[model samples]
Target: MKRRRGSGLSETQLGYLMVMPALLLVILITIWPVMLSFHNSLFDYRLNDPTRSEKITSSNILMESYADNHYYLEGAIDNAASSTENEEAAAEVEQFAEQYNSYHEELMSFDGVEETFTTVEEMLAGFENINDNELEYVEVDNEFAEEYKAFLEDSAESLGTYVEEGNEDGLENLQSYVNSSANSILESNFVGFENYIDYFQDSRMWASMSNTMIFTVASVFFELVIGLMVALLINRSFKGRGLVRASVLIPWAIPTAVSAMMWSYLYDGQSGIIAHYFEQLGFISDTSQLLSTGGGAMFSIIFADVWKTTPYMALLLLAGLQTIPSDMYEAAQVDGANRWQQFLKVTLPLLKSAILVALLFRTLDAFRVFDLIYVLTGGGPANSTESISVYAYKVLFAQQNFGEGSTLSVIVFLTIALLSVLFIKLIGSDLFDSRTPRK
Candidate 1:
């Protein structure tokens, strides 16, 4: 006599429901940042530029700047006008002030603007800095901003002329104030895809991308070859194998920045043992060439990267080597296959998945190489080793150009994404093919 229970979700639906939280977390962590970077890339955002500091879709007035400038502007203009003995010059100055006053009056008439302006004026009188949420950046009609900017520019020019000819007392300061006030009235900085277009045409961007490709390809290639050999060597049962395995991981275990710093000293022209040896071996004409020339710098970074990460690659491949059944190798030997033939037929085929995974990880890491190159070569020696990541960091932080930097960031993301897709496709096909049930 109990009521019948309704059916719950199907197995597939329940499975999806269980994973929804994790799926949302992954999206928030990965997709949100990429989307934010794309959004920033569409505008002319820069910290050094007050007008374009924030992403603006319409004309706006920075009330803090407007209030501060207006306070000084009125006094400057009045004093200059009163000081001029020439009736004509005085009358013209008065007319300019009147026009400016009318514009100010109109701006103050906007909703919430007058209230914010009054608050800012009060703060200024008290010599107090405006705190967050206390001041408001009021948006206005684009036409109005243009007109006000034009009027301020004209007023500044007239003031400059009056001051230069000694027609008015100290009008130069007033001219500067007027100019600053004009700048406070910002125009829409949003220029969709303009940053992207500019980067495509930029020579430095292409150069950085080329450097990234070269570093990625060379470093990953060497790591794969050397790592395979190391993995093969360590896979066999031998005395002190545990110690050897632990020793191999020392370089990989060191922090990248610290490793780079250590290598920087080793590559130093005057004191480094590696550089001295390279010189003695006739690889270079002088020890200094190791880090002071384009080829040498590229080689140095690749060598350092291979040395540090080869152990990691070996570890991954070693895991695959461990998974192979001992019987497979014994069976190959019983079939009259030599060691080399057995390795070619059995080891390589079984190790494919691990190799693919290692290559994918190493390739991505090398492509985004920044900290190592940044700390060591500093993208110097004529920027021959500057990776795209380093270039983006310089633009984003050093120059404070967020818009262009965001464009660079997006490009890096896209390139990494393309590489990931390529690797996944290759790996996915092999894995699925291998795991498919035999007919």
Candidate 2:
């Protein structure tokens, strides 16, 4: 009988159709955000500073603040000129006002700016807020922005000297007006690859990366060893095996942040049982050293992480262990193979895929360690235990420096991507080797 062909789409097309939703979801969540971050990383974006608060590609005038400031600014400077007693200072202030008026006229003369300025003035007079971006910001030439910003800054500085010597009354207010107007003109903050360059040169970045590597390696290594031992113990038939497995998973089941906080108390210098025991056992010279010293803090976090995550690793391995048949051990025993020989010849070979999977998962997880370290040490004791993730969080949120923060985030993504590729290569090869039967 011929194959039924009700649908026109081929099998490959149908396969893609089935997976399209998942592919779209991944792009939406993962790819879209990374691309946005990359675009932001090119600029000097920050929320705290009004001048660089937005991602500007070219010079632009903040019409709302500028229009209001300019309305008062012109009158303020003219009033200062008339109110001053000193002829020299008065002449200088008048000259400054004339120069400023010329710059203002030049700025307004720019194509479309005059119309935008008129519209902005009308909105301000009627007390209507300029909420539309197109109406609120007018793009201008780079040269004019640079000149205008420089003139306002210099004028403010010169006016400050006059105010100090009592050369003019209201001179301070005039200076303030000049400064406010200057702030309304934002220059392009776009700086492609410069943030990356600076961060690569930064000592703190390298230090955090180094700490991340150390933590990943040490914690993963210990977890593998300890987890395998636990998996083997639990895999064997014994009374209360179910209870033992559940109890072992208690640490992994606890939320990372909560467990980290709990460990912080245990590692506390004063009135901590673990700290006291460690000190008495000659692990450290004093109880305070556990979280106080750089080496001690790194060691403390690594130890805590191994204790918390080993159970999870054990669970993964135990699943792999259960898949192996008892007949393999029986066959090995009939061949006069010792326990160690059976483990080496049969158990290890069969568990290769499981070990590779567990390693890859734990390695990636350990590399991105953040919350536990954050809650426990706060990346302090001189930032000796600070990972790249913690450093990125501080820059992104605490400092409100989005540009540099995004750059750090991109670095993290790239590193994680590279690590994933490496692991996948090893895993793919091992699985392929296993599937191909020996001759």
Best-matching candidate per TM-score: 2
Cα deviation of 230, candidate 1, in Å: 0.5
In the predicted model 2, the residue pairs found to clash are none
Q: Write one digit per residue (lDDT tens) for candidate 1, span 119-226.
A: 888988998977754475788989999899999988888777767777455477778899999998988989999888889999999999999999999999999999
Ten-residue segment with the worst summed lDDT in candidate 1? 1-10
Please list the residue runs of candidate 1 whose C-alpha ends up more than 4 Å from where it truly belongs after superposition: 1-7, 81-102, 105-135, 154-169, 426-428, 434-439
Which residue pairs in candidate 1 have backbone atoms (N, alpha carbon, C) closer than 3 angstroms, thus clashing? Answer: none
Q: How do all models score by TM-score?
A: 0.88, 0.94
Query: What is the lDDT, from 0 to 100, of the residue 285 in candidate 1?
Result: 93
- Quantify all predictions' global Cα lDDT against the true fold: 0.89, 0.92
lDDT of 2 by residue, 1-439 (tens): 3343469776777888999999999999999999999998999999888899999999999988899999998789778877888787787788888888899999989899889988989999999978899888899999999999999999899888888997455788898988999999999999999999999999999999999999999999999999999999999999999999999999999999999999999999998889999989998999999899999999999999999999999999999999999999999999999999998999998998899889989988998999999999999899999999999999999999999999999999999999989888856466555566669
Q: Candidate 2's error at 1, in angstroms?
A: 16
